[model samples]
Target: MTQPVHPPKPRPGDRVAVLSPSSGLPGLLPLPFELGLARLREDFGLVPVEYPTTRRMGSSPRERARDIHAAFADPGVTAVIASIGGDDQITVLPHLDRELIRANPKPFFGYSDNTALHCYLWNTGIVSYHGGSVMVELGRPGAMAPLTADSLRAALFTSGPYELRAADRFRVVDRDWADPATFEAEPETDPGDGWLWHGPERVVEGRSWGGNLSVLSWLLMADREISQDLSAYDGGVLLLETDEELPSAEEVFRILRAMGERGLLERFDALLMGRAKTWSFDRPGDHAERARYARDQREAVLRALAVYAPDVMAVFDVDLGHTDPQLIVPYGGLVRVDGPARRITVTY
Candidate 1:
C-alpha cells in the first residue's frame, strides 16, 4: 500500500485556489457562492482565487483538469478547495495530471460527488479532506456550524491527531439562499444523540479510506479509482455515508451486500458511518418520518456488518458527509478508532 504525503499547511494570508471540479453552480447561484468566498476571506483570513472554469456551467472535463493543474502548479496557491461537489467529477479524473498534483500536494476539501477526486488523491498517495465544501457548509443559509468551523480551522492549520466529536445539535433542512432574510438567523436543530459503536473490544489504528458510499458503488461498477487488489485496504479504516438522495434501507443493505460479495467488506478493521441524511427539498419529511429513516438506515448497515464482517469495529452517526456540523475526515490519512475507549481521532 502507498503511504500518503501530507501537504504544506496554509497560513492566514496565503492564497487558496477555489475551483469547481464538478458542476459550476457558482455561476447559476451566486448567493451561496459569494457568501462562501467572503467567509474564506474574512473568517479564515485566506484569499480565494478563482479560475476560468470555477463559475462556468457545462465546463468540459479537460477545462476542469486545466484549472486543477493551474491551481496546484501555481506557487502562490497554498491550498485548493472546491466551491461545491457535483455528480460528474469522475469524468474529470482521467484528465488530471497526476505528477503535477503529486509534486505540489495541498489540502483539498470537499464531499459528496467530490468523492471522485478524494479517491483519485488516495491512489496518488496524497491525503485530502472529505468535508467542508465552500458553497455548502461555509455558505450555509444561517452561518457556518460551530463544529464545522472548528473542524475546518484545525484541518486547514494543524497537522496532528484531532479527536472527533458528535455535534451538540444538527440540522438537515436548508433555507432559501435567495432570500436575504434567511441569513439573518440560525437554522433550527435537533438535539444530537452520541455515536453508537459495535464489535470487538480492541482498538484499530491505520490510514483511512472510503467516502460517500453511493459514489464508491459507482466506482466499483466502473472498475475505476479503486485498487484491484483488495488487500491494499487491509487494516485500514473505512468511512462511509449516504447523501440527500435518501436511498431506502433496503438499497443500503443491497450495496453493502454487494461489497461483501466482492470481498470488499472484510478488508477494513473498522467502519465509520456518517449520519444518514433524512430530508430533501423535494421530499420534505416530518420529524417521525425522518427518525424512521435514520433508524432504518442504521439497521441496514448493521445487518450487512453482521453477515460479512462480524468482528469489525463499527461506529454510527458520525458527523461527516451530508449532515450539518460536519467534521472533516482525512482521506488516505491516519485514523485511530478506539472501540474500548469510545473515541475516534483522525490526522488532519
Candidate 2:
C-alpha cells in the first residue's frame, strides 16, 4: 500500500466545512457548537460553512455520508471538521464515496466515533486529523485551554513536525453543555502527574494508527477498515484511548487481548496511550475514585502488552483523547516517540 499523504492545510481566510458526520449533537446542544463556530472565525480567522444536516439531530447514515462527500468535494472548503462524535458512524462508512474523498484530499478533523472516518481516510491513502472537533476542543467552556488552542492551531494550519506536551493540569469530568452557567468559567481540572512510561528505552518512529479504543473495538467487530493482513501495521505507532462512557478495566483488557489474538499488538513497536477520561455524567466519581479508575485502566493495558507485545514501548496519558488540553495526532502521518528522551512529535 502507498504511504498516506498529508492533505493541504487551511489558510486563515479560507472557508472550512463544519460537518456533523456523526450524531449531530449540535442541534440539541447549540451552545458549544455555536461557541466553537465563533472561535473558528474569530480565533482562527476562518469562516465555517455548515451543511443542511450539520446541526440536524437524528440524521441518517446516508445523509451524513452525503454531507461528508459534499465537504470533501467542495474546492472552496479547505477543511472538514466534525460537530462532535456520535455512536453509529460505522454505518456511515458504507455510504462514503471513497474515490471522491481520495481524489479531493482535504484536512478532516475529528476523534471518538469519528475514528471510523479516520480509519477510512487512512485506507484511502489520505492523512486526516484525529483531534479538534467543533464542540469539544474548539467550543470548550469559558476560554479554550491554551494547550488545546495552540495544538489545534498547529494541526489545522501548519504542516511540519509538532511536539506533544504533557498537560500540567487536565479535566476528566464533563459539565452539561445545556446549562447556561457551564460556560461561566473553565471546567475544573486536577493536577496531572505527567505521563507514565513502560517497556524498553529506545526511539520509535513511524506513521500513527488507532483512535478511541471503544470505537476501534466496534470497528473490529464489524470487520470494517482494519486490515486482516496483520503485517499492514508492522512498526506503526499505536494511538489508543478510552471515551467518556467510562469503560471498565476488564473491558479495556478484553479489547486489547482480542487485538492481540488477531496478531495486531505485536505489529507496533510503541504505544501512545491517551489520558483516560475517568469520570463521566453517568458515573460522577470523586478525585480519588477517578485516580483509581485511571490506575486500573493503565494496569489493564500493561497486562495486555506484557502478554502479547512485551517488547513494545508504552507511554500512558499523553493528553490526546477525551482529556482536556487535547493534542492532535495526524492519522497515518509520521510520529516519533523517543522513549529515552521522553518525547513525542507528530508531522501535521
Candidate 3:
C-alpha cells in the first residue's frame, strides 16, 4: 500500500485556486459563489483565484483537467477548492497528470461528486480533504456555520490531530441562491442529537478511506481509481455518507451487502457514517418523516454491520456530509474512532 503524503499548508495571505471540477453552477447562480469567494478573502484572509472553466457551464473533461493542471502547477496557488460537485468528474480523473500533482502536492477540499478527485489523490499517494465545497457549505446562506468554519480553518492551515465534534444544530434543505432574499439570513436548522456508537468497547485508529457511498459504488462499478489489492484498506476507518438523493434504507442495505459479498466490508476497523440527508427540494419531507427516514437508515447500517463486520466499531450521525455545520474529514489520512469513549478525531 502506498502511504499518502500530506501536502504543504497555506498561510492566511496565500492564494487558493477555486475551480469547478464538476458543474459550473457559479455561472448559473452567482450569489453563493460570490459569497463563498468573499468569505475566502475577508473571513479566511486568503485570496481565491478562479480558473478558466470554473464558471463556464458545459466545460469538457479535458478543459477541466487543464484547469486542475494549471492550479496545481502554479507556484503561487497554495491550495485547490472545488466550487461544488457534479456528475462528470469521473471523466476528468483520467485526464489528470499524476506526476505533476505528485511533484507539487497541495490540499484539495471538496466532497460529494468530488469523490472522484479524492480517490485520484489517494491512488497518487496524496491526502485530500473530503468536505467543504465552496458553493455549498462555505457559501451557505447568511453566514457560514461556526463549526464548519472552525473545521475548515484547522484543516486548511494546520497539520495535526483535530477532534471531530457533532454540530449542536444542522440543516439539510437548500435555499434558492438566485433569489436576493435568500442571503438575508441564515437558513433554518434543527437540533443535532450527537453520534450513536455500536459494537464492543475500543478505539480504532487508522488511515481514513471512503466518501459518499453512491460515489464509491460508482467507482467500484467503473473499476477506476481503486487499489488493485483490496487489503490496502484493511484496518482503515471507512467514512460513508449519502447525498440528497436519499436512497431507501433497503437500497442502503443492498449496497453494504454488495460490499460485504465482495469481502470489502470487513477491512475497516471502524465506520464513520455521516448524518443522512433526509430532506431535499423535491422531497420536502416533514419533521416526523425526516426523523423516520434517519432512523430507518441508521437501522439499515446496523443490520449491515451485524452481518458483515460484527466486530468493527461503528458511529452514526456524524456531522460530515450533506448537512449543515459539516466537519471536514481527511481522505487517506489518519482518523481515530473511539467507541468506548464516544469521541472521534482526525489528522488534518
Candidate 4:
C-alpha cells in the first residue's frame, strides 16, 4: 500500500457525526456532553448528529459499528468525531466493515480508546485525527483551551502544515466532572515545563503513527490493525501518550520492550511523547509525587529508546494527549520533527 490518503475537510456549516465509538459516557455524563454539542453548533457552526448508541451506555460492539457505518455512509455527515474515549473500543473494531469505511472515507477524530479507531483508519489508507473529542476538548470546563481550539479548528476545517507549540502552562490534575462548578472554571494546572529532547539533532519528516500507549499494547496483543509488513511504518513519526489510568512506568517500558522485541520500535526515526498525566482518582499524587511519576516515566521511555531505537529522535511533553489543552495530531498524516530547531509540525 502507498501512503495514507487525506480525506476532504469539513466545512463550518457541514454536519459532523458526534458518535460514541468508544464509551457512551455522554449518556452517563450529560453535563459535558450537552455542553460539547452546544459548542459544535454555536461555536463551530457544525450540526452534531447523534446515533442511537451514542448515548446508550453498554451498547454492543455491533450496535456501535452500525452507527459508524451509518455515519460514514451518509453524505450529509461530513466528519465523524467521538463523543469521548473509553475502554474496550477494541471490541468494536472487529464489528467494523473495512470495505465500507474505506469506500466512504471521511475524517474521524479521537484518541485514547479511540486509538483503536485511529489504527483501523490508518490501515484503511484514510488519514484520521488523534484528538478533538467532544466531551474532552470541546466541552472543556470553563472554556476550551485556546491552543486546543486553534489546533482543532485547523484539523477540522483546513489543510496544511500546523506547527505545535509546547504548553506554557499545562494541567494534569483532575476534578469532579459531575460537579456543576467544574464547568465554571478551568481545571487546576501546574507550572509549565517545556519539552525535553533526546538524541542527535536532525530533521525527521514523515507520516505520523502510534497512539495511546495502552491501546497500542492491546492492539499488539490482539494482533489487530498493525501492518503485517512492519516496513510500512519505516520513517513515520511515533506518537505516544498515557491516559488518565496512569499506567506504571514499568508497564510503559514493558509495552515499548514488547515493540522492541518485535523490531517495531526501530521503524520510526522520531517520536513525540505527549505530556504524561500523572494524577488520577486512583493515584491522587501531590506536586512532588507528580514530578516523581513524570520523571520515572521519562526515564522508562529513554531506556526503551536506548535499547531499541538508539538513533531515533525524541521530544517529550508534546501537548497532544490527555491534558487541559490537547492539540490535534493527524493520524497517518505528515509530521515533521525538527530537532535542531526544537520544533514539531503536522499536516492537517
Best by lDDT: 2
Error of 2 at 203 (Å): 0.4
Residue 99: error of model 1 in Å? 1.4
Off by over 4 Å in 4: none
lDDT of each: 0.91, 0.92, 0.91, 0.92
- lDDT tens digits, residues 128-216, model 2? 89899999899999999999899999999898999989999998668889998998889988888889999999999988899999999
Supply every candidate's count of residue pairs whose N, Cα or C atoms clash at under 3 angstroms: 0, 0, 0, 0
lDDT winner, 1 or 2: 2
User: Tens digits of per-residue lDDT for model 1 on 1-348?
Assistant: 756899989999999999999999999888889989999999999999999999999999999999999999999999999999888888898899999999999999999989999999999989999998889888987689889999999999999999999888899787877777887888899999899888897889988888988888888888889898899899999999999789999999999999999998899999999988999987789999999999999899999999999989999999999999899999999999998899999988
**Model 4 lDDT tens row, 257-344:** 9999999999999999999998899899888998999899999999999999999999998898897688899999999999999999
TM-score of 3: 0.98
Models 1 onward score TM values of 0.98, 0.99, 0.98, 0.99
Q: List, residue by residue over 201-305, the lDDT tens digit for candidate 3.
A: 798999988898888888888888877788999999999999889999999999899888878889999999999999888898988999999999999999998
- Count of backbone collisions in candidate 4: 0
Residue 277 in model 1: shift from native, Å?
0.4
- Model 4 residue 99 lDDT? 95
Question: CA shift at 26, candidate 2, in angstroms?
Answer: 0.6
